[model samples]
Target: MPIVYSEKEASLQEVVTIQEVDDLLEWLLANTDASIDLAECRHLHLAALQTLASARRKVSAWPQDEAFKGWIKPLLTTGE
Candidate 1:
């Protein structure tokens, strides 16, 4: 599953598509302190990224893939 929601974490694995945005947003809103784990994420849709960014969710883990980490890390860190 791309987005796996739990009480404490929202794990993003493999590829996260735009289709997951709505559910992601709902989960984020519902779980205010839920942290996101992107360690296994290979790709993420712009819409999904935007939803996470807009919500200012905390990233619990970053992807191991350097290329994916390079771009996503800044987005998560800079709060932009």
Candidate 2:
């Protein structure tokens, strides 16, 4: 799974694709206080990006990939 879910945390890693978006959204909704970790994330499908953008969850860690971090951080933090 691109998203590794725990009791109160979700770590997005590898290439998160469209297939993972539904489950990712579900998990975020279910775990209302959970934070996300994206340090190991390599890529994100637009759907996944949208999910993250709208969910408004706390990000525990930013992606290690500079390009990806640059692209996604603003979108995720826009509402904060």
Candidate whose TM-score is highest: 2
For candidate 2, write residues 1-80 as lDDT tens digits: 78899979999989999999989989989998998999999999999999888888889899998998998999898455
TM-score of each: 0.92, 0.93
- Give per-candidate clash totals: 0, 0
Model 1, CA-based lDDT: 0.87
Residue 77, candidate 2: alpha-carbon lDDT = 83
Residue pairs whose backbone atoms clash in candidate 2? none
Q: What would the per-residue lDDT of candidate 1 be over residues 1-80, giving only the tens digit for each residue?
A: 78888999999999999889889999999999778899989999999988887777778789999998998787777452
